[model samples]
Target: MQVTSHFYAQLTIAIIKGVASCLRLFHVLGLIILCSSLSLPLHAIEQSSNTQIKQVHLHDNQGKSINIGQLHVQADGQFTFELRDEVFSDHFLSMKEMKYIEGPELWCHIAYPYPLNRDFNADKAWLSHDLLFMYKKSNQFGAMMWQGVYYKFTKEDGRLIGYANGVDLSEIASAPEQIHTPFYDESYMEPHNAQERWLPTLTID
Candidate 1:
């Protein structure tokens, strides 16, 4: 009878231990869930692709090639184009010259009022670097980056501030790239072969 009681007691103790272990496990899992829920970043999903970088180059002064803006998109859906040139110059937008941007709903803020009086029109900027000219289109009143550089002007009344930039090709990569695709852009222009039609911008480098 004593042996039987001892066995029963041991079995009860084992069961109690197992139950406590299970409860502790559940408690730990609950804490993890709560912390994760609180610590989630608002832009975690939005910025997942923000680290991408794209190739940008512009013709510079001395008739040389330059890489100006390191263009990339942001989590808040804006373009942050980093330029190598500090001061505005006569040529070399991709190498610190102006950058052209085209993105969704980005043309409004930079556009002036249709009647485009001087007060309504934004100041014009001529980017000497890369020979890119930025002028507010009076009729459309949106900023244009002529001479191949990307630039923007602002009219407080306008809805869009600038052309929204596109995604960076390098952002789609996983590891450092060893072999790079040549920057030959002739194909980007050949489609406009029809007479008088504007050709797509091509890069010689």
Candidate 2:
């Protein structure tokens, strides 16, 4: 009888220890799973906060690339490009096939047109267009856009060449009212002249 009682006591203690060990193991696994789930969004946010760079070509109205520019895009969806040389020259624009040879090396900073939403959809087609750029050489308010919003070019120590096509905001029902900003005007775009030249094409190579 005494031996049987001792055996039962030992068996009960062993079962209790086994159950405690399993509970501890399950608690540790739960902590690990919780930590892993919490880190997923953190990893995604880190990747989204990183800036990206791309090589883009600025094409002219004739579908020819004049120069290559580097586009620096921020995580917030804003972007800018650096132009190293003067694009428009009488020799290059007149001839269809010629190596772009002559221009002074200077930095032309192209800024974004407006504040882009963080969730703005980056359309590759928008980047590749026979678009027109409106810029102020001194103020550095450079903006480029396609022929959808009518731009009213205000003559500030600047010139506009009608080489690129224009958009009439009145014709489009979906055109935003912001197109009437002082940066542009309703005046007809004058033809390209020697003094005021249009933005030349850009190539990626």
Candidate closest to the true structure, highest TM-score: 2
CA shift of 60, model 1, Å: 2.8
User: Relative to the true structure, how large is the alpha-carbon lDDT of every model?
Assistant: 0.34, 0.41
Best by lDDT: 2
| Candidate 2 ranges beyond 4 A from true positions | 51-167, 174-205
Task: Give the range where candidate 1 is weakest over 10 consecutive residues by summed lDDT.
Answer: 104-113
lDDT of 2 at 76: 77
Candidate 1 vs. true structure, TM-score: 0.28
- lDDT of predicted model 1: 0.34
> In candidate 2, what are the lDDT values of residues 132-182, reduced to their tens digit?
233223232322212222222222333222233244322333433663232
What's the true lDDT of residue 119 in model 1? 18
lDDT of 2 at 115: 33
- Backbone collision count in every prediction? 24, 9
